[model samples]
Target: MLAATASQTIGPYWHLIEDDTWADLTRFGAEGETVVLTGTVYDGAGSLVTDAAIEIWQTSPAASDIFPAFGRCRTDSNGAFRFTTLKPGPVAGLGNAQQAPHIAISIFARGLLNALITRLYFQDEPLNETDPVLSMIEDEARRRTLIATRTASGAWNLDIRLQGDNETVFMEI
Candidate 1:
């Protein structure tokens, strides 16, 4: 009989299995409104998690042969990650409700039992007011955690906090 081996967590060495091209969703000549999303990951102690891996999934505005609808990026020494992709449109939610345009995010890091799930929404999008998920978050401050701010250079910025006074709102699934 074969004995079961111990399960291992995905650690800082994820880059070993990561493809460099996975960081850019527009690599195959996808045409649309392209934007850059940038952010940093912080741990419970407020220190940077320099080796976390972040994955984002979003439906494109239109059918495209180039857009893969998913991308992955590894945090740098400063815990920063960036992705270049097209802006997504609002999607249908449960019971005929519409969800705001957003990107679904999954974060993998050292010391984590499982990947953290979250969503990133654009700050200036008016549709955010009626988004089913956003509306469900009663705490205004906590809801803000899911919104990404537009930078002066036209990039969207979002910071993820594992824990603290400003901990980000992570989804259960």
Candidate 2:
């Protein structure tokens, strides 16, 4: 008789997402409004988590050879990561509803037993007002944590806090 092996933590592999090219989803020449998504990761104590891995997926342009709609990035010493991807558009929600334009993101870090999943909603996007998912959160402050605000350079910035004060809203898988 055999039993399943003990589960192990996902990774600390530097080779996986180290390639700078992997951080650029637009490398395939994806068309549309291309923008850089940037952010920093912080630990529960509000210290920088310099060794986190981030992955983002969008549904707007759809996945394809020219537009994979996905990207992976490894945080730098400053706990910052950047990805070049097409700005996603609104997507359909569960049955007869519309969701605001958002990018699904996951983070893999040393302390996490599993990747933390969250969605990045655009700040000031009109659709956010009526999106079913956004409407579910009545607390404006907590809900704001998921929003990506545009920076002066026109890039989207959304910081992630693993815990403590301004913890990011990670969703259950």
Candidate 3:
């Protein structure tokens, strides 16, 4: 019997098979408070990770013809990614607790055996204070890593750091 080859991580050529349109969740004209979420992905050395793939899942409001509630984007040459979508409302969590309005993030990059999971919470959301997930984080500074700041242009910005002192807080499932 022939031996099986070792499994390998996704290569840099992922973009070749992914359509750029998948990055915009509002491409079909979803209705709600639309905002542009933009950010860059960095590696352990703080260098741009140009080949990373980011997927966001919004859990709120029933899916409609316009809002599919999910989107995927690949980082550009500058390691930046952007998503156009509506603001998500609070979703129910364990034990009837409500989670803050946030987007679930999954990151796939080179050197990672498994995709990293995180979340993007809007800084201006009052519900963030009582969010089940955010409240569980004991370190205030680390909790801030998951919050996205609103830009002057009304867009939301949040960078994802894979490592280093400012590394993002990735969640385990």
Candidate 4:
């Protein structure tokens, strides 16, 4: 066996803070729809990015909810992250249009001081057919890049590509 080497001290804020409020507040039931948000965080070079913070938020299906509706999680060694969230309802879109049910995702990494915003819709969501935002993208394959799919176990799995081929489209505002 190899012996451990002496290590140098790190920064003062190296410890993590505990917050149990990360649990999904959405109620899950027989008629209620649920999605497993799973994805791999990556760098611009297409390498797996570990230990990056990924935060996602969406308006409640109830629609009467208040602001600051979001959830967050960190990626593991495999650059995989997952979250259990309720399906969002249609929200007001640009001008007189409306958008489909989608979850607003933001990525925070070493180089990013502010999070990069993106949205994830479902492949089978009927609202996608009428979504104004999705309608702007003429390419079906390009639009599908932002959509996630459900697994055999009833969880939604979304593989996020930071850069290069098949990358998830990031948006401003």
Per-residue CA lDDT of model 2 for 128-158, tens digit only, reads 9998877878889889989999995558999
Considering lDDT, which of the candidate structures 1 and 4 is the better prediction for this target? 1
Model 3 TM-score on a 0 to 1 scale:
0.92
Q: How well is each residue in 38-145 modelled by candidate 1, as lDDT tens digits?
A: 999999898999988899998646446788888999999999999999989888788888888999999988888688999999988989999988998999999999
Give the per-residue lDDT of model 4 (tens digit) for 55-156: 787875552343235677777789998776666778888788888888888777665655677888876878899897788788887788888887755577
Each model's lDDT: 0.89, 0.87, 0.88, 0.70
C-alpha RMSD (angstroms) for model 4: 9.9
- lDDT (10s digit) by residue, model 3, range 1-173: 99967546676777777988888888888777888999999998989999988999987755688888899999999999999888888888899798889999999877876789999999978899999889989899999999999985659999999999888999997
Clashes of each: 0, 0, 0, 1
Candidate 2 ranges beyond 4 A from true positions: 1-7
TM-score of each: 0.92, 0.92, 0.92, 0.76
Candidate 2's TM-score: 0.92
User: Clashing residue pairs in candidate 4, if any?
Assistant: 36-156
